[model samples]
Target: MTSETTRKKTTEKIVVVGINHAGTSAIRTLLAQDPELEINAYDRNSNISFLGCGIALAVGGTVKNPEDLFYCDQVQLDALGAKVFMEHDVLAIDTQKKTIRVRDLKTGREFQDSYDKLVYAAGSWPLDIPGVPPEKARLKNIMLCKLYQHAQELIKKADEPEISSVAVIGAGYIGIELAEAYRQKGKNVTLIDYETRVIPRYFDTEFTRLLEDDMRRAGITLALGEKVIDFAPSPQKPDHVGQVITDKGHYPADLVITAVGFRPNTDLLSEAEKTGNGALIVDGAMKTSIPDVWAVGDSVAMYHAALDRHQQVALATNAVKSGIAAASSINGIPGVTVESMAGTNAICVFENNLASTGLSEAAARELGLPVASSYIEDADRPEFMNDYGITRIKLVYHEKTFRLLGAQIGSHGEINHTEVIYFLALAIQKKMALPEIAFTDVYFLPHFNKPFNFILTAILKAIGLDYEAAAGKSLERRPSLEGK
Candidate 1:
């Protein structure tokens, strides 16, 4: 007989709140570790694993099938020996008691469910404006673009003949994509944002200027540096939102889609410690402050290797990573925690390709980081190659330590090198310096890249090595930006 000291601890029951990417990842990882583990998953939404990233593709008619957006469903989870409650809402959670109060939307029945461990993956919600009154939310043709239903509504409503002019609030990825999508559908599109530059968090002014020039050339109205006040009623349809009113000016808009931002849906557990944005703070193991409780996805703030602090990065990549971390820790899997959360991202619109990882120069300076940057535009391959294309790169790093902090890649050519950001992201995570990046052994061919690729050239330029090679002299270190 096994003594009490030698007895193995078992996690028989686990409760997962929300079944988006984060919750779905956690559920799959846990079941793979132990098939017999009884898990109960509750989500307020009727669907699961609705990839919001594909919404723009769907809207642009690039994705022919809507079914392709979903990778997992409640049926699959149910068949995997885990009970999935669709349209079921978890009203409250008690970590001390290890129980949750749940309400089934179908039956309107309330009940209590017990769990040995809890994984909170509540995800995030589209940010709403406080200036716009609650009644304004009832305005017709004013929609959001986060959920599957929202995507369907956007695709359907955008095709209407009456939707001749479309205005998208917020010039972030979603807003810009939707604007370009509408333009592709032959509608006059207008993109509005308070920020002076689009995607300011991930891009600097130079990159955004190129993107903005492309958008303007495509006939998309860019109302940057304007504050949205309210929506006005059209004379034809008083109930519909006709045009968006801004502090600077008002533009005619038959339809308005708000893609302002997202806020984490982590307020359900009042006792849990959270960030200023209400995202739950999680440790390296994805465990929250409360015992037996873990938080993942956009609903939680995980430590960023580059930022050296917990931040709410609402990207599917981080969400999936957090979910895997939570489940692996619960399954007693060691050394499985994600070592990098660089917040890497990419976007292609209007034939312009852009990708970023870690931090932008503006974001780093805002956080009081002693950051310096090196930007260069050069041929992706040997200039002698007939099909060579131009690629631009910017490398940001700490001026003192020369540690890689971030990288941005942009190109208007057919052959894009944006994927090179993955290597830079690893460098930031490992705290590699510019000299190390310059020495990386990357394969090069005329069809792909030059012997000294654009990434290598960018790094060399950062540490004054490129000039050293040109002048036939060696330079020891990079010149300080602050000293300039």
Candidate 2:
């Protein structure tokens, strides 16, 4: 009789897998807009919505409480009319039947549920060290930084008197951050990575050299370009890893943390279309190849606006964006287009803040793009200011068209380097050229910046021009214009 009752009767039942960044965001977005929809979300992890990035800060005592890392829980979801299921793993999915078989970890009970639509946001899991027996790899001292529980366990182990040395494998963001965290706790930290440099994926040689110098100055050991062979157990405690055996040699490691990388958790969707790395392939609307099944988050491959292809970028920003897009498509919202990601990312190391967007120079070369790059080092603020600090910037562009490809920013001071990259990312998305940036209208002040913005200076340098000379000519004509 009532419109509300009619809508409820026709409401679609949606099932969401995982309760991490993407899954939770999709549920929240759908619930806020559509009260007529029935939603059920499942996650095997006991906790939901854990800030994986903040785990390092927590381990380093920057975050005093471990509980602070979690921002959402089951009770909050339940209040929002979501059928929340924690510690429940979806064993298998029957896309044809629109049903999923789920098993309860607590009660060991299994059941099947049907849905009109399904969203996959299972995220990723850390890759285990290869060639090691499962039993040996399960050593008490061997740790991971992927989950909040992992951070808790790592902190507990770090407090042990016998755990005086720590060996971190892989030199990506997580590896470097955890190494710094353990080092700050007064533990002898050795960082091992097959790559010759630190954060090679995000930064160039100059920025990485500065980070390496900072790490070594803080008494951290570097084992670059060495392959980890195996973990040797302690003579006294066979259940714990005592040393890390690499291709070069062995080093005492009271505890070992592997940050090698993460692989998308898409085994359940083996029959579905996926990228070579197992990331689910989805269209702009976050729709997978199968009808009524959508995917998002780290488990899905997104279109790279700069590269003009689909690639997997595991970041909370991408997760949230894709999640909203999927929910919007389901809710029949108009004009909700999924923007292509430029892989915009930022991280702080010691005193330096580094950020990058789009493709790097190396990435462009690898893709066989004819590109040119310019690097500039300038003061973040006018030299007249005492708070002035150096900022290094690098921009990559198409050689002929001058189309912006990517940009990287690094600064030693408290200046927001990420904001610079954010603007560059937007420019890349718009396919802007170098000349556009050179004459771009930007605010200026002596205390905050020079008359000419650094971005403009960098573009001028790339085009074989000088901003200083241009400024001088403008100043020389200022007095004559005033007389008129």
Candidate 3:
């Protein structure tokens, strides 16, 4: 037998609690290495892993079936001799007793399951607007964008002709996507945000301006620098029963979806008292302040090496990485250490795929660092190939050292566009110099890319270096917040 099979045969008890992308990936990876590790997961949802990013696309009718978005099924887990409990709500975590108090939602039976090592990957929940109690959620047409069931219900409700207007109360990622989805369905969509601009924390003002322009072109109404103070059902028009009272003005609507970000899922560790900002405080190894108990995903906050503080990065990548990190630590093994949990996320906005890693320009500037940025706008290939796609790449670097700090790319070329951010992330992790990136070898083809590629072109400009004349066109420009 292989060493991996031998390791699995020798391994002992291990229980992973929660069923999201994080928990699923962790269990799958650990099982691959050591299948003898006892695995048990508890989630109130019917499925183990769900692609939350595709929920809006599914609602927009782009995705034919909802099942296509569900990542891991119960049968997959069952094949591994793992007990998959659907609709199993974990009530409490008794670290002292090493047992998790859980209740089967179907049978209403409670039980305590013991574990030698526990992995808490209980993800996150969307933020409920302040002043709107749980009773407000009782409204027939009002809901928050979360869970697959919510997406299905919204899709069905949004399809009604009577539901003409929708007030989405946030300009974050989910809010932006949901707004576009509603607009695609021929509904008048109004997005409200307290921030001055959408995605203020994620992208620079110029990039955000580009995104806003795309949103406006897609027929989305934005009420930025405004907060919804109260909600009242319309008295004059009962069919149009929703009224959102914002600081700027009142918005009339038929339905509302509050996508104002999320709070970590840390309610189970109340007795631990080390919880802050809805997440348990954890160290670099994903161990909580309380001994033996570990937390991962959105439910736990850790120090970001880049930002250097306990921050919550509620992305799927961070969730899965932290879960794997926690599992390895529990198994007395060394795992990958992610200095920064800020996700390297790739998103499709309009026709362009925009990807980002580490900090945004604004975020980096906020730390009082002297930062220089280079903006290179060029095509991904030669003009003769009939595949001309414009790409905008922004590279952030330290003014003194010229060390690569962060990068963001927006483009249409699928391969080059997707890998640029990931490649930049690797460079940032290794502290690679900017001058060395221009020579990195990449595939070349007439239909695929130009000789130097867009990424290499961007880096050469950022590092104040020169490239060969035989490559594609290049327009190197210093990026500033003035025109944007």
Candidate 4:
């Protein structure tokens, strides 16, 4: 332990450099646990710890008010004895002196503050196209839905009855969700992706076909296998028209939402190098290369066990975990060691739900693992209750030992985002065998589920055995295969 860690002060001054789900929740939880720690948070935006992810949902009319997405309020944080500094931009960090230089964005005044420990959950920023005219960013129709303020503007402009067509760039989760939202709002939504298919990073070709069909059914136009070369105002309509020029063709658009992807907010930490295209390299405890300075959230490069290297997993769950891990390490508490964190995430496609955990049919094969997978679409609940929903569950396992490797689920079931999905995520991460999971006493109820849910059933099927026949494979196997 260092002298700083051992010092018994009345209150340990801890400063968090950003405000988002990962940073805000971590700061609040840490202060709650350690009352002796004084928490100071810095966010340049007026709305700190806002639910930027739900902006699309708000535009889709799922959320009534923009305030519904803001998780942390000043009243709540002040009650927790936190000094929440809004509109404060952290400019630089002097790690050696344990001081941070910050400026008030509104007033342009600068100040330096010292901290016992520093946490950089600086979060992420939307990536913009290079050499794109800066004036294009100022265009009335050009949009990048990122912060709460940006979403508010998009909502205001989209609500206008005159705005009819939208062009969404990039086919990642955010882009897909936003496109769906705009289409739901009765706009002609065109989704453009450089890849041949949408969600190419997560889904296999077959599964992507299913999702593509779903999007088309939802009234979204797909311009796949093309690159958006440039954006210029429409030649026909000088005042309001915008053109999306791609390698293949040019399409007219009333507005454009760029969801190309995000890069980690790590420019302030000049000493730390990138671990990947979108993240910072960190140790097991979330400590950066700089001492007494730690990083988490979408900004840090995480250890991916399946791929066996440090990479970025830009998801809310991992960000929150990384933040909490950094806090615990600072407090000298033990954390659950993780071999890999690439797990399932749930996406709401209107009434339908798409969820996946670990490697998909594509990611597993791309790693060159000799694997076999099964996709089974079955009922999740009893038909007697008039409750029938389809769950397409896929499980991938090694052809030899039948050791569990990866899982994905696509369904319109009501409980798709319920506890069962989270359990499967944990199961995949732990590398639980098929038989063990199949025989496990999962909760049962008529409205909820049956004894052996579709996830376990699918796992058993992947191992080439029925649920009943796979009951004792854990004991039958002479050796275990994990992290090898």
Candidate 5:
């Protein structure tokens, strides 16, 4: 028999908990590459590989079929030689013994299974206030925006004729996206945030100000710098949430969505080494504190490229990348390592597309770094081009070293507008200095770009370097124009 066939005959059982983005990616990678491994994946939820990120698009009617959100199912996993337990909930893990206690949600049967290896990819859950009692907080019209079911429920509630005013708590990505979604549905949308601005964590005040203007123009109300106290029942509809009570004031609402944020789902491994936020601490190889056990996805803290430390970043992109890393490490794959992430992200607000990589000016200041920032406004293409649009870029770097710390880009729906931010993410990871990008060579086409690339212009401006003078010097040194 071949080595592969022989290895498959003496299979090693690998058990994976939670089949979300991370778990699914891990299992698929392991099965596809390592035929010697027998994989069993468990999840309490019936669905597998549901794209929770797409929920906003669905609510906005950008996604036509809700079913398309799920990319994989139990049957598909079974076809790939994985034992899929769709409604199986893992209760506790015995790391020393390499055993897990699981409960079948459908039959209420509980059992223990042993594994040669265990991977934790439980993901995250929406955070609820502690002091507020569940009865007062959990109103019929109040919803969350984390899961596929939550999206369906929100869409159903929005379709109701009685539900007119919608209050979205937290000005993070999901909150802002759902607010716009409700506004597009012709509902009166009011976004409430404890912070002073929208997406305060990822965006600086300047970028947020421009976005806030767009929000106001779109008729979406912003109730910033207010803490949500509780959700109270409406006097008219006692069963539904009628009012959103905040520390500053109260607002009338037929429906409320709490997109405050999420916490890592790492309760099962409470004894494991974790960050303050309860995210398990894993290394570049995706190995957890416990031996023969690994963790990936939102449940674990990932190395932040810019910060040079481990931080919890709960994005699907991180999940998938770390998941594959975990599998490869377990299989003894050579030359595979998970790189530190820069927390690169992008979003579209109304007609504006905003993208960011690494730390923002606000984030750098909060970290107490001596930073310098530059903002530049220029057209995406030549001014004479009919399809030209305005593009604004913000670059942040260290004052002393001029090392790029972060970058943000905003454009008026220009094609491939996020490319500059994507490039900056890599540059920050490489520890590139400002001078490297200030005079970087970039191809130019009048139809798609200006003579001087916007990224180059922004970098030059960041260091007070004159782009015109630098271009003139390059022309003067050209061999063909030496005598002219």
Candidate 6:
């Protein structure tokens, strides 16, 4: 251990660079466990813990109170014996000297501070289109749906009568959700993406095809397999972006939202080892390449159990885990490891209840790994039960080793078998193979599941077994959507 780790101090002053989900989790954990520890946090935004996950719900009116998105604030952090400075931008980090430069956004003030420990949770920023015109910047209608302010603006634009058409670029989770949200508001919505399939990082063609069909049937233009070139300003309203230019066609849109993705805001750590995407590469203990400094939230590229490598999986759950892990490590708390994170996520959009964990079959194959998948479609409960609904579940595994790698489950009905993904995610973490999962004990209830459930039957089908004596698969059809 380094001298810094073993050294005792009356109060270790911790300077956290961000106050979002990851940063909030870390500060709360550290000060909560040891109140004497000094915690000072800085956030460029006016608020913290704005759940980007619920932005779509808020936009679609599912979440009535837009303010409900924020779970933590400056007042809460202050009450926890931590001083949080809102709208304070971190200018630079001098890792060797263990100091940082900061600027008060509200004033023209610049200052330097030293800390015994640093938590680099600067989080991430939404990706913008490259090489756009000045109009793209000045245009107020063009949106990026990743922030609380962005959500409020989206809600406002959706209510504007002039905003009749919506074009969402980058049909990933954020883009898809915003598209659905605008569509729910009775706008002409078009979801555009460079990829041929939506959410390809999670599900395979069978699932995406279903999702695409559902979106199309719901009057959402699926401009897939097309590259978005730029946003073209409206001739009538020169101050607003009115169209999206793709290589294939020019889409008319009164409002344009880009949800391409995000990049970790970890540029201040000049000497820290980072991924190809600039996410800090941290170990199991959440310690970065630099000593006495750790990274959490989207800035940390965590070890993925299924991929068996360090990857930038920037989900809120992973952020919270890494934050707690870093805090635990700093507090001398052992046996706290976030090494088994599987990138487990679920989404319910349009009519599909979908969930996925670990690597998809396509991703496994793209990596040139020997991949196999078992797919099954059946009722959630016994056929005799009048309330049963059809659910589709697929298991992806190593072809020869049979080690569980990933799983995807979806259904059109109200039945949410997504919880099954938790077990599969754990299996992936434990390196459990098909045989181990196949014979695992599971409940059988008429209302919940059959004697041999979808989870059990999926493994059985993979091993060339027929859980159904003579009956074929049965399920009711449903529309598809949701992600990240």
Q: Model-by-model lDDT, in order?
A: 0.87, 0.86, 0.75, 0.76, 0.85, 0.87
Q: Which ten contiguous residues of candidate 2 have the minimum total lDDT? A: 475-484
317-392 per-residue lDDT for model 1 (tens digits): 9988888899999989998886557889999998888999999999999999999998877767775766666777
Give one clash count per candidate, in the order shown: 0, 0, 0, 2, 0, 0
lDDT of 4 by residue, 1-484 (tens): 7665665554578899887877776687677677567888888878776777898889988888988888777668778878888899999988889999999998899999999888998888888866566665556678788888888988887788877889999998889888988898899989998889888676666456777877887788899998877787766666554878788988768889899988888888877867747478887788888888888888888776445578888888887787778878777778633346765576776445666666776777877988788766556776576745556677776777665666666655354633455666666666676666677776788787756667766775676666544564331232111111
Give the per-residue lDDT of model 2 (tens digit) for 27-87: 9889988966799999999998888898788878899988988878899888889999999
Give the backbone clash total of model 5: 0
Given candidate 1, what's the lDDT at residue 247? 91
Best model number under lDDT: 1
Q: Which regions of candidate 5 fall more than 4 Å away from where they truly are?
A: 1-9, 414-416, 467-484
Per-residue C-alpha lDDT of model 5 across residues 108-179, encoded as one tens digit per residue: 999999999999999999998545558978678788887778878987876788889999998999899999
TM-score, every prediction: 0.94, 0.94, 0.85, 0.86, 0.93, 0.94
* TM match of model 2 to true structure: 0.94
TM-score of 4: 0.86
In model 3, the runs with Cα more than 4 Å from the true position are: 1-12, 132-138, 236-241, 270-276, 281-285, 302-305, 332-342, 382-387, 412-416, 439-453, 463-484
Candidate 5 has a TM-score of 0.93
How far off is residue 315 in model 5, in Å? 0.7
Ranking by lDDT: 1, 6, 2, 5, 4, 3
Q: What are the clashing pairs of model 5?
A: none
Model 2: C-alpha RMSD to truth?
Answer: 5.6
